[model samples]
Target: MAQVLEFKLPDLGEGLTEAEIVRWLVNVGDVVAVDQPVVEVETAKAMVDVPCPYAGVVTARFGEEGSELPVGAPLITVAVGADASGGSSEGSGNVLVGYGTSEAPARRRRVRQAQPAARNGRAEPREVPAAPAAPETPAAPEPARPSDGPVPVISPLVRRLARENGLDLRELTGSGPDGLILRADVEYALRAAAAQHRTAAPAPAPVARPVVGGETRTPLKGVRGAVADKLSRSRSEIPDATCWVDADATELMRARTAMNAAGGPKISLLALLARICTAALARFPELNSTVDQEAREVVRFGHVHLGFAAQTERGLVVPVVRDAHARDAESLTAEFARLTESARTGTLTPAELTGGTFTLNNYGVFGVDGSTPIINHPEAAMLGVGRIIPKPWVHEGELAVRQVVQLSLTFDHRVCDGGTAGGFLRYVADCVEQPAVLLRTL
Candidate 1:
């Protein structure tokens, strides 16, 4: 007898809870090898191809393309053993984040392995637990679930989401495979509660609510939704303040032009600025940190992981330059180019998009002069650079047409005072004003 093993949507890391199915790579009865890409899923971070762990025949596929599945929702069922194609029950040991197919890491398989009868295409429903528990002890007030009964939720992320939102998990009805309470169920409950509350409020609520006629409404999901949620959280949680300074970038441009003219690989202004950011962060390590609100402390980082804002067709994504402090101008240039291309092509990974200690936003690329940037939380600060344009400036005690650029730094005040923030921005501006100043640190 062949054993059919089910594959759930593996946790795509970077704290992502769910993913929308972009495309299905295999159909039912298709023979799949271990670690074969079975489905393409678009998480909040990036597009990823989820691989099947078991080498077998795909017996069944769960959820259609364009359906969003929670982290633990079944993606595909593969029949293994002698009768199956490839005839193997062993996994490739290359499962995605938070998923394991081996006998070890018993907690991961507890949701399925405990119930031997539910191994095939059919996963046992929550009622099965309730049914067996109640008939033995019929005198209990609650039969479906007592305080200690299983909650019918497999994904810890779903549990965490409900806990954080002040929503009770037992109260929510599962709409997922085998009556599993997925993240969608919790989200739906929250939305329903919000809608009901809005309706029950005073008559003035009608004035604020959008009228549903002749309006194009889009559900904020995928990348767009992720951006909205992050930006909103940054605004809501961060006590951010912006400070800007106008500096003569004429020298900075001249240095770049000279470097390019005499170089094998052309250097980008962004790399130079990133170098400057790293240097400045070395001096004012306060900005290179994040606020640990629960601990009531500012967690400062030893190394600078510089994040640069890249606007792509997918939306605005900040791809991080890992260990920016150690990389030279050439390395930084190459890394920035690679990350920008990845961002544009929508191939950037979750690791590339997160763990940024600081962000360098070049709104100047969009032809804007200056902006009060929002701090990319839980980051402590962001450096905003505006367009470098020919403007009349006092140079060598004389009025001259020079490349002028505005530098703005938005910081979490909880980390450092305005003096430290001002010093950091001033150091960055100084580097732009005189590129030679950066050479001492270099």
Candidate 2:
């Protein structure tokens, strides 16, 4: 007797409420094996191809491409070994794994320990012990610490940058909402400090603190809207922070130029930087993880899907290069070209935009020296590469011009602290500064 099976939408790691159907790799009546790619779903992160949980014949596709599916909603039906309601017919009927489970009540029994009787007949009401007295209140408030003076609250990315550059956050003014410190503020302060160090004198701390305006509103739609939602959710739900470092992009640029000159497809400087970031994420798997609040778990993936922010006519789209950590520079360059073309033409499928383990955004393309970007929700961190410019540098008692780039890494603080974020950014810089580092690992 042939049986029927129902497949529902699975939890795609980011706790997303709904997902858009990108495409169907398999059609009705097609026999599929367990773990076979059946369909692709697009979440906010990237498009993910879901595999079949059991070998069966596809009976039907419930939804059409481009339709949104709520979690646990059935997407397909199949005929397996037994009837569709084979295993356990509890809440909402049974579906495959990744697809949410049916709601079912479980009965569990617990045994309570017996309590000893009080010595006195005060066994009355179990003779509860008297509560401890409250502590006395202080006469005055405690003094504030030196570090607490006028410190501007900025994004996690700024805080991480400040810490790495040995910046005193209290001395910097904010440019964000309500006097919040901004990534630019931290960068300016760091540059000022670096200049002071070169002059053999410490500059007086900045006293003029800037206050952010009270009523500022930005419409949340398209790319900016998506970025706002992701960043806000990351800051509120994920304990996140940021770190910054300077990368000597002189050699990386040379490599890029050379690669391009030799009949290689022209790739963006950002692509080279992304390749380095992808390599580093492979070495440090923690950076490629997501925090599961409901399960209270940190999930680390074996593969890397490096998501890069692409500004298109539609909005800001992050097209991912799947299995990025395993690919070479040439492969990445080609893939990036394909992704960019698709994004520009608005031909990218929903699946092309989901499933990122880490992200990279090149503010450098805009000639920005340095700025903190918000962390992508669920992903632990995002690496922002600034424009590489030829700046005067002190090299062994001589001042010379060299190409340098700033790297801003914003991470979820709930998972890693300043120190960890710093280490990860530094690792990424090292890989970019010395591409040979990846050669050995790869």
Candidate 3:
């Protein structure tokens, strides 16, 4: 006999409670091997491939693509034992949080039938009612009402979209199974509302009314949602302050050019800036620490886990470089390139996306001069670098055009005061203005 085993979604770690099914690799009746990836899911952090711990024929699948399922929800059911297409009865030893073969089999729950009341002190056999026969015509579903309680919305992005547009999700009909509201349904409702608004408005004679369309709404889920949640939390919880300085980056640019000209592996400008940041953090260790809200104590870090913000098609992601203080410009350049590629391909792991003492955001690529960046939560500070452009400056008491860049430091006020923040920014600006200033720390 084949023993049907259910495989529930495993914890992806980093406090992720749920994940949306991006695609299913296996279907019903498909033979799968142990530890084989059965589905690809997108969590707030990153895209993950969920592996099945059992090797057997897939009997059923739980959710459809794009449907969000909480951790421990059944993902698929597999049939084990020789009768199940000659599959093995033993499950693979590979372990995930909720799925493993080492644990004892779970006991099935049994339901007891209701007994008839005693009649005249003697038990009388009650007549059992027959099950209702299926009607020839299926009845129509009941109309959704305002008192239907809360709408079934799994994605926070969908809820936010409806809330921002003043659209009541309960009034709209969802195209998903079981009336599960999705981002697309919210967008469609918005478009319909806009069309209705335009039609109701009176138009002046001899004036052409422009058609309102072509609005593209990308759902803030996966990596984008993760970024949004982190930034929002950082703004709400942390007492953050920003300090910026315009530095003559001509020296830094020149130094980078020289290094690349004589280097075995070409160093990147971002890597050079990262090197400067790590050196600055060493001098001002206060900016490289986080506050323990529960303990109400400032937790200082001995090593630097530098996170750099990388923009991708999926959204903005900060991939951390582990022990960045120990890595040189060449090594940092290589690591940054690798991580950036991973971000682009959406292959970065949860480990790469977290555990940073500080962040370096190079928003200069967007062609902006400067921005007061929000600090990455739990991290004390973030160094924002702006575009390096030609600007008039006094060099050696003579007016000259130099490559200048703006450096902004956003620090947590709870961790350090303005004096400490100013000192850190000044050190970084000095390094940018004079690359030789970094040599002292090196």
Candidate 4:
């Protein structure tokens, strides 16, 4: 007789309670092997593909694409032979953030080397002498574990990282007790596997990768959904008024080059622009405020949490550099590097990504000349920096080749008018055009 096995959403690493189903890799009745990719899931921070844990024929699918399912909820059912149950168990698979596998009770397979001694050849159960019980008081609820499955003992950030990287949980050998996998184990496995491929002898020539056709519809969830919604709302709801200006960043670039040569964190144009924008906000505090029509308040922040948009495999995520007004050039560079690294590696938390007072989208890295960028919602303004193209400029009626770049500042018309927004942009341009002026504002 074929045994029916239920597969639930595995606790996608960290303590993620739920996740959006991205796409199913296999269909019902498809024969799946152990550790095969089954479905894709999106957590708050990244997109992850989950692997199957049993060899069987899929019988049912519990959730559809874009639907949010709770961790440990039954996602699918499969039919397997009775003899297949005793096979070598690799891990079930890496949990998507807030997602988990089957809700079956944890298998208690303890190889106890030491236990409480038996009395008179009788195995005695260990007991704890409880403190005097409170009078008929109810027991406080315990904190949530991942699910009915084994409680994965890994950090939330590590779980997110593993999910984003498409790592198989079973392939990673857990160092934790009872063979629980850790983040380091997964990372080490990835590195070691990569090294092995590099050292291995050349095999027979492989066929070229297949070309995919047709429009692929990927699910928008987690950070990508949040980013798309906020930007769309800001564009449709907020009357975004923008102004453009060209600034000579020759001096700024020279100063940065000199500073980086002095054995400090190498500052990028975006980092310098971030610092400049923060200083400019000091003079025009109104641009640093948010509008709340429902609350009848214009929330103004005292400190600048400068948010820079970084593109990742999951989606566009902006990790804020907290207190941008306080950090100097070197410190700001360090913070930007740390935030960007965390964002790329899927280690940044929700708090670090949210609560931005202002945003900066740098298109200069892509070598784009200019663009009219949409503002990030709640915040009044977003600045877009264009590429630093070497162009001839008329200086004192004479043609001179100079480094020139455009700046586009988009702001909510309800909160900031053209004059206010223009002044802020000019101030930032002036600061960038002449980096020495930033010292006084800070």
CA lDDT of every candidate: 0.80, 0.66, 0.79, 0.70
Candidate 4 per-residue lDDT over residues 37-128, each given as its tens digit: 78867667555667777775565566666578888776665554433233333345444333444433334221111134544322233323
TM-score of 1: 0.75
Q: What is the TM-score of each candidate against the true structure?
A: 0.75, 0.52, 0.74, 0.60
At residue 38, give the lDDT of candidate 2. Answer: 80
Q: After superposition on all CA atoms, how large is the RMSD of candidate 3?
A: 12.0
Q: Per-residue lDDT of 16-79 in model 1, one digit per residue for the tens?
A: 8999876577766567888888887878777777888887666567776567888888888765
**Span of 10 residues, lowest total lDDT, candidate 4:** 106-115
lDDT by residue for model 3 over 195-272, one digit each (tens)?
877799755522233346534466777677788899899999999999999999998999999998995999999999
**Candidate 1: residue pairs that collide:** none
Per-residue CA lDDT of model 2 for 151-207, tens digit only, reads 555433345356546676777668788878877777777777678776986666444
lDDT of 1: 0.80
Model 1 residue 122 CA deviation (Å) reads: 11
Q: Candidate 1 — worst ten consecutive residues by lDDT sum?
A: 104-113
Candidate 2: segments with Cα more than 4 A from true spot: 1-225
For candidate 3, give the lDDT of residue 76.
Answer: 78
Q: Weakest 10 consecutive residues, lDDT, candidate 2?
A: 120-129
